[model samples]
Target: MNSVKKIAMLMCIGLPAFVHAGEAMVKWHDFNDYRDVRATNQAKGSYHKQIASSIEKHAIKLAEQLPKGYKLNLEITDVDLAGDVSYRGANEIRVVKPIHFPQLTLNYSLMNETGKEIGKGNDIKLKDMSFMDKIKMGRDESFYYEKRLLTEWFGEEILPKIN
Candidate 1:
């Protein structure tokens, strides 16, 4: 009876370790864009494009940094723009035109080769602040901020939990 109990305990402990021994790979799928900014606005379009591109680049970097022999995959499920607004000023005439900043929400899923979800992260907010400040200063700053956010999220929240 004791031997059977010991065997059950060992199986429970060793099963997951064995399952995790296989190599892991990560890939990114399509991402949703929920921002309401008009495509005609060149500046807004450029900004949005940069954000999307940066996210993809960072995803690849994070995947490469994952521990060896563990397979993982990331799929972008949705991107939700929470809100956006513009400010305009005039002295009986249009001087400084309205500038807009968009708030974004991203949802993603992390899974393994078995089609089982290992972990999922959602509603990660990426806020656009170009409307509040000069483009020269805001553009580079926002890009760096977004990059850092992605790194932290993947390293702290996702990587550790991955087998």
Candidate 2:
């Protein structure tokens, strides 16, 4: 029937619009590291940048998983990354089993495209004690630890809570 064909065409165009109605986007990633410069590592700024990149990546994934028309605004401060090298004597430091925990104070919220607050104060210290998993570290293994924490947090906590 002519009416049935019109209904089918209308459904094809209308369904996707409804399905994507609550989707979100990564509006910004604002990282502020307030660690004392005296206790900072050589790669402090660069390392934090890498962490921000990981957050942006995962936030986008999270946005896709959530409903449509929302945006994520995240501000991370007081970043303390894992591991510390101990000074021995000369311009060198001991690298044996340098273990430390990474922590970041995160302040984040979600807003609709029309500027409605969907969530807030989700202010949390981003840290995962179980990320290491008793794995032996080679040289420069610190790079992956923070990312693992972010990924697991997004998957287990944020993803389910928002969607």
Candidate 3:
């Protein structure tokens, strides 16, 4: 039993090496200065922080597609969520109107393990004017439109440049 325990411990020690993959560093500008990030009527509190956290998490997730030792640094300068704020029955609500669309302005740098820049973009504007026209696989997801916009940008713009 002692020998088996030693083997398990050894395996556990080595697991982290295998689990480490590509990394992403996402930074956000001042939320107060952003274009729009209004919370829905059901939001509890800290709506700005919630949206920032979601965007950061999704950006990191998309960076997983990079090569094992690559790193992506993304700095988001502005954000405008895909809806308009309105009042309904004395409650503030976010209405997904046809005019409102998701927009983001960002800068990014992709670097290899040696810390050499492989690709970079400045003032990259991302706008999804037809955000509502696309079919969504995760309709109930939080920040669905924003996430999709990032995914499309990462896949089409960043991935292509790097590859």
Best by TM-score: 3
lDDT tens string, model 1, 69-138?
4444444433433223333442121122224343435566665556577776665665545533533333
**Which regions in candidate 3 have their CA more than 4 angstroms from the true location?**
1-20, 42-45
Q: What TM-score, computed on C-alpha atoms, does each candidate reach?
A: 0.45, 0.56, 0.83
Mind giving the per-residue lDDT tens digits that candidate 3 earns over 1-163? 6999999998899766555467889898877778887676545358877887888888888877776788999999988988888889878888887699999999999998788998999999999988888887855877888889899988887788665
TM-score of 1: 0.45
Cα-based lDDT at residue 33, candidate 1? 38
lDDT of 3 at 74: 90
Q: Number of clashes in model 2?
A: 6
Candidate 2 at residue 25, lDDT? 40
Colliding pairs, model 3: none
Name the weakest run of 10 consecutive residues (lDDT summed) in model 1.
90-99
> What order do you get sorting by lDDT, best first?
3, 2, 1
Tell me how candidate 1 scores on lDDT: 0.51
Ranking by TM-score: 3, 2, 1
List model 2 lDDT by residue over 20-84, tens digit each: 54443433343442541122345656755655566567556555655566666666655655554
Clashes of 1: 3
Taking the candidates one at a time, how many backbone clashes does each contain?
3, 6, 0
